[model samples]
Target: MNREKTYGIGELARDFDVTTRTIRFYEEAGLLSPAREGQQRVYTDADRVKLKLILRGKRLGFSLSESRDLIEMYDPESGNSRQLNALLSKIQERREQLNEQMREIELMQVELEEAEKRCLDAFDR
Candidate 1:
C-alpha cells in the first residue's frame, strides 16, 4: 500500500509560491493549524486545499476576515447549513457589486474613447 505524501511548512510555501512568512502569518490568523513536529510545522493536503481557497477568496477581493468566515464554514466540526446558505448570499452580493463596477468601467471606457476622438480631431485641424 502507498502512503500519502505530507509536506513541511517550507514545502507548502513553495507549493503555493508564497513566502514561509506568509504561511506563518496565515497560521497566526487562524486560517491553518498544521501539526508541529518539533519546531517545524507539517501540513496535510487539507491545509493545501484551504490555502488555495483562501488565496482565491483574496484574489476575488474578499476581506481577510470574510475569507476566514467562509473558510470556517468548511470546518468538519461545525456542520451547519446556515453557513452554506450565507455563503450563497455572499456570492450574490459579490455578483451585484461586480455588475455595478462593470457599468462604471464601461462608462469610463466610453468617456476615454470620446476624449481620444477629440484629440485626434484637434491634431487633424
Candidate 2:
C-alpha cells in the first residue's frame, strides 16, 4: 500500500516563499485546513493546491473574500464551468478597475510634469 504525501507547514511556507504566519492567516481566514499533529500543522496536497490558487488570486489583485468565493465555486466532482465563468467575470472587472486607475495615474503624472516645468521656469526667471 502507498501512503499519500503530506507536507509540514514550514515546508509549504518555504516552497511557496511565504512566511508561516501567512499560512496561519490563511487558515484563520478559512482558506486552508491543515491537520494538527501535536504542535505541528500537516497539510495535504489539496491544501497545497488551494494555497497555490489563493496566492495566484492575490497576485492577480483579488481580495481575500473574492478569492474565497472563487475557490468555493470549484466543483471537481461535476465540472468547473461555473467556477470558470465566475472567475472570468471577476477578471474582467479587475481589468476595468485597473484600467481606470492607470488613466488616473497618467493624468497625475502629466499634471506633475506641468507643475515641475512651471517651477523650473520660475527659477529661470
List model 1 lDDT by residue over 1-125, tens digit each.
98766799888888889999988999999998998879989888888888888888888778779888987776455666767876788788899999999999999999999999999999999
Per-residue lDDT, model 1, residue 7, is 90
lDDT of 2: 0.96
Global fold similarity of model 1 (TM-score): 0.82
Q: Model 2: runs farther than 4 Å from truth?
A: none
Query: Weakest 10 consecutive residues, lDDT, candidate 1?
Result: 74-83
The TM-scores, one per candidate, come to 0.82, 0.95
Q: What digit string (tens of lDDT, one per residue) describes model 2 on residues 10-56? A: 89999999999999999999999999889989899999999999999
Candidates in order have lDDT scores of 0.86, 0.96
Off-target runs (Cα >4 Å) in candidate 1 are 1-5, 75-80
- Weakest lDDT window of 10 consecutive positions for candidate 2: 73-82
Give the TM-score comparing model 2 with the true structure, all chains together.
0.95
Residue 41 in model 1: lDDT: 90
